[model samples]
Structures are given as structure tokens and as C-alpha cells.
Target: MRITRMLGAAALLFGLTVTPAVADASPSPSASGDDSAPTSAGTSFRTATEVDQGQRATASASTGDYLYWSFPADAGQRPTVRATVKLPATHAAQTWQVDVYDGLRRRQSCQYGAQTRTAEQGSATVELACVLRTVRAWSEPWANDPLPGTYYIRLTALNLTTADLGQPVNASVRVGSKDIGGSAAVDGSLAKPLVPGIAVSSQSDSEDGDTSKAAVLSSIEPDGGWTSGWWSDRWVWTGIGAVLAALAGIGGYALTRGSGRPSRVPPGA
Candidate 1:
């Protein structure tokens, strides 16, 4: 009889412990993925392959126009470039080529193929095209340790005779970094010595703690499919919830201080 009684007590204790554990383990519906979906379309910029052309050049016959591509230009310094050149409606040409250089310092070339019609407007028309002669033009991958300086791009128009066209050279190239899809190297000035506006907060429970900021700015999703957010593995909210629950349990204990204690004076004595 006593053993049965003990078994019932043990079963009751086990039930109490197991109930909360099971409840905690049950999955709950939640808004989990991509909490910060961009409300508007993202800004279009050049990728490593796409270069940027900022402004048009004044008319010139002596030499072709030059375009400038800036590094560290945007928040993330994406390494791609784009440029547009509008040819005079009267001008006719059969072949064209583009030359990309390291701003009169190191000469590099990328042949973006031939000019194709992109758009047409009143008195003026735009052709979407690139200057690539051979399969591998001279465009090079952006350097992580790029020296702070100016780079140049030269566009040339070829006539039907496969030679220089008398028409003036006027075009633009938009310059930017390619979509590395990985972390760019950090420089000392922009890298170290944490500043409020600069550093991205690290995962709370990360081994490095809050002290670790991302080495480089994150322009896109992380490389390994990892993500950052409130519900992400090391979120502070889970710790916050546990803290609040502990406080509540403490308060409940304090409230029950006298519930089980016998009074000094006998009841109904």
C-alpha cells in the first residue's frame, strides 16, 4: 500500500515537471523570415561587371571624351560601373569600341561589344551599348586595397571603314563595384575604432558579444545564408523573456510569504 502511495506521489511530481516542458517545446506561429522586406524597389547601381558614367563631356574633335568612375562612392562602395552616350542623330557608324583605364595611370580595356539601340526621344536618341572588342576586354576585378584615386574610361566610335568616325565623342560611364556577394576588406580609417554611426551591432549572445561589429558594410544578404534579427539565434528578446519570467516567479513567492506558515497565535484557541 505504501509503495503504491509513493508511486502516485512520484507520478504527480513527474506530471508537473513534464507538462511545462512539453508546453515550452510546442511550436508557435510567427512572422519569421525577412522581417525587414524593402517597402520600395532597391536603387539600381553598377555591379562589378557594370560600370557607372557620371556626367557627359563637352564636344571635342581632337580627342574622345573621358569619363570618371569614383571608388568609395556609395554607402557600400559597390564595384560596378554604367555609362550612357547619346550619339547625334545625323551621325552614322558601323563599329565602336570602349577603352577602360586606371585614370591615365594604368591602362585597362573592356570591350562591351557593340552599340545597340536603347531609347529614342525628340531630336535625341540613346543607344544602350558597351565597348568590348575581344571576348575578354581589359576590365579588371576591383582591388580590395585600391589606392584612393581617380579612374578614367574612354569611348571610341568606329566608322564603316572600321576606322575613327569624324563625329565628336560624348558619352558617360556610371562607376561602381561589382556584387561581390562577400565581405570587402576593411581599411583602417573606415575599419577600426568603433563609432556610433559606423559599427553594426553584433549578435547579442555571440562569443564576441556586442563588441564585434561587421568588418565591412553589408550591402546584401549574408554569404552562408545566415541572417540578423530579433528572433535570430542570439536575440536579446529571449533573454529578456527569461528575465521577466524569473521576476514574476519571485514576486509570486513574495506574495505567498505567509500562505503556508502557521500563525504564532493558535487558530480558534
Candidate 2:
């Protein structure tokens, strides 16, 4: 009876300990959208017009054409952008690029990863991935800061070897936001202009100078990556290890209990 009671107590403890970890491990609901078909020059990031975060937009472009989209972001939020291009048979083997820009119109440096393949009948598909760092201000006063605001993504086709210069390729763009666990100094607004113009009113000379500097800083390089959110976090793997240990303990305890049972002898003996 004592052993049975001990086993019951252990089972209860296991339930209490593992339940919360499982809940914590569950994934948060992500914001996502898709654009099946996009129009030519469908949106402009220059005008601060962009698809909402967690949403996707599609468009068709040819050589020398640009497709743009914007999404809102906050400090400590890691934003990821992906672009996929589907080229027709005639547009195969062309070079393409995707660039990321911050609210100040500064060209942000990003880690880029791409894959290309020749499809059936000379068609090709290209996939591009760009991941932005947790938004934050620059440490130096003269350096360009990645503040909380609308970020833009530009997709362009570089060179076309095909004779059909007008041949259009379908492209899709997607943006995702993940919380890296920090607060920003300020929040961002979609209505705010990408580059604030110099103040004409009699404001402080310092304030006016700051605005002018930001406009010129738009050309600064960006910092970004190509990894997904799940792979970027360390705590997730720790939780997984804890759960596995608890399960192993329970299985071992059950086997020992079964082995301890007494065997029955035949009545004829």
C-alpha cells in the first residue's frame, strides 16, 4: 500500500510539473497574409505605402522594373522578409535581387540567401530570404539608427538574357514578426513619412538639423539574416530536454513496478 501511494504521488507531481512546460512550448498565433496575384508596380515604399505586417503581396515585374512593399516594426521585434520569383520559360537564368530599407529610407544591410533551379521547359524559380535584426537605434550619433517604423522591401530583376525583354515574372513577398523580448524607446506609426522633410517653421536649429541628417542617411547599409524564429531561440531547446527527461523517469518507474509482482505456481505441483 505504501508503494502504491508513493507511485500515485509521483504521478501527480509529474502532471503538475510537465503541464505548464507544455503550455509554454505551444506556438503563438502568427499574423500571415497572401497575395495570389499582384499588379505591376502595385505598391510604392517611397510613398510609405506598404502591406501590413504578417501580410503578403504579389506582383509581376520584368527587367528594370521595381516592386516595393512596407511593413510596420518595433524595437526588439525581428522582422523576416521572403521573396519568390517564378519565371516563365523565356525568362530563365536571369539575375534578381531583394533589398531592405528602414523608415528613414536608409538602405539596411541584410544577410541574403537564395536558391535557383531550372524548371520544366526552360522555366526557372528563385527564392530569396532576408531577415532583419531586432530594431534599435545606432550607438553613435553620426551613424544611421534602425528605429521603430515602417520598413520597405524592394525586389528587382537585374539582367535578362532572353530576347523577350517584356516577359513578366510573377513574384510573391511575405513578412513575419517575432518578439525577441525587449522594449523599444518609442513606438512606430504607419502614417509617418518614410523620410521626414526639413522643418520650415521656426523650430530649434538642432531639431531641424537632425531631420535633415536623417534624410541624407537613407543610403546607409542594412544588417539582416536568413534564419527563422524557431531556430534563433535557445530556450526552446531547453524546454524540450526537460520534457524528455520527465517522460523517461515515468517509463522507468512503471517497468520497475511490473517486475516486482510475484509469480503464480501451478496447483498440481
Candidate 3:
């Protein structure tokens, strides 16, 4: 009876310790393990890769330069993501590494042990490599999925040869934000008068006693389109027209007064 009691207590203690550990390790299914792919902004993205070669290290020393790939210009629904990194012709037979990062500069995924081979023998000749364009290192994220923002993708060639080769390339993509892509030219309206976001107005008295009007417009967001302001469209038109008409009258008087008339007559004998 004593031996039986001791064995039972040991078994119960073991079960209690192991069960908690298993519970901690296994996350809730609904929380992170649905195996569903992440959503994105579906913006078109393109960025170059960096290439290099080294003498000491088998792979070349290359750093991918991050470039702005694309983004959403307006707010909209989230999209699914599809990204890729391409190796150029100058790449030699060696292992390479590709890394993906989030907006916070945190490394999300790293994939190494990639090999490349080409059937070429000349410097100018193109070397061909075959691999999956889009690599998925994880089926699901550890915590929440990536939110709408800019993300970076980096690729480095490993085990490179001792020769000057292609440059390293890095690219970025805007994941969810609506303002992540190229912009177009905005057409001006009468009310707006194409006044830029930051406009500096200056009035200076010239040597000839005429006031010169000059303004510099700084860059603005939603630049190439109509923008909202304090005044209504009708009120803005009325204000702009009144100011421009007054300036035009002043300019006209200056031109007429300055025309065919010398500020000072030549000294007479």
C-alpha cells in the first residue's frame, strides 16, 4: 500500500508539470494557426538587387539597396501579397540568402542554403539560375499579421568568388496604406489658381519704384489634385479673382508708365 501511494503521487506530479508546458507551447488555433495567407494592398512593386564578389569569403559582400517599390494612393480595402527577388546574370555558382523585414525594421523571415549554377565561362556572358521567385519561410506569423505600412526585402549572395560582379539590390513595398504608389499631374481650377501647399509671397520695391510680386510654392500631398481648404469653392473663387484683378491693375499701370519714358533725361548743354 505504501509503494502504491508513492507511485501514484509521482505520476500525478509529472502530469501536472508536463501539461502546463505543452499548453504554453501550443498557441490557440483561432489566434494564429488558421494557416491563412496574409493580406496586403496589392500594389505593384519593383526593386533592384545588389551583387558583389570577395576574395576571403566564398560568397560576395553585397548589400541590397532598399528602394520605394509601390504603395496605395488612396484608402481602400487590404490586399494579398506576392513578392519576389531575382538574381542577375553575373551571379556565380554559390549559396545565397534572402531576408524579409517589416516596417519596424524587424527581421521577419530569413531563408538561406540557396544554391545557383550557370553553364557559362566568360565575364560578359549571362549566367542562368533557377529558383522559386517567391519563397515562404513561415506559414503563419508569431503574433499578429503585418499591418498596413512599408516593408523591406533584402537579398545577399553567399559563397561568392573573387571577382568584381553585379551590385547588391534591395527593394521595399508598401503593404496596406493607400498612399504607396506613383502620382499624376493635377489639373488646376479657377478657384484654386494652382496655389501650391507652401506658398511664400514677397512684395519688393524696385529701383524704378515699382513693386514686384513673387511667390514660391512648396511640394504638397495629394498635390496633383483638388484640395480642401477653409473657404468654400465659390468663396475661394471670389477671393482669388478680387486679389488677382487688383494686382493686374497695378502691373498694367507700371508697364504703361515705364514705356517710352526715361526715368531721367540726359544733361542738356
Q: Please name the candidate that would achieve the greatest TM-score relative to the true structure.
A: 2
RMSD of 3: 32.1
lDDT per residue, candidate 3, 1-269, as tens digits?
A: 44355446555655654454344333112222222222221221233221110000012223232232222111111222222333444645544344444433454432222223332332322222222112111113454333222334343444556652445432222122112111111222123212221122322332333434433232222223332222222343345456556655665666576557687889992
Clashes of each: 33, 9, 23
**Candidate 2 regions with alpha-carbon error over 4 angstroms:** 1-28, 31-44, 47-49, 115-121, 137-139, 162-164, 183-269
Q: Pick the candidate with the highest lDDT.
A: 2
Candidate 1 lDDT, 50-151, residue by residue in tens: 122222222222123223332222111222334455555554333334444432234534434333332322224343433322111112346322222233
Candidate 1 similarity to native, TM-score: 0.30
Tell me model 2's lDDT, rounded to 2 decimals.
0.57
Q: Model 2: per-residue lDDT, tens digit, 1-269?
A: 54466556666766775565455334234445344322344346654335555555777666556778766665446677888888876544667788888766788776445522223335577788787766653224365656555677888766555574677678878777665541332333222223333232113345654444444212322224211122322344455556667666776677677756468866886
lDDT of 3 at 189: 17
TM-score against native, each model: 0.30, 0.53, 0.24
C-alpha RMSD by candidate, in order = 18.7, 12.1, 32.1
Off by over 4 Å in 3: 1-91, 110-144, 164-269
Ranking by TM-score: 2, 1, 3
Q: What is the lDDT of candidate 1?
A: 0.34
Name the 10 consecutive residues with the lowest summed lDDT in model 2. Answer: 220-229
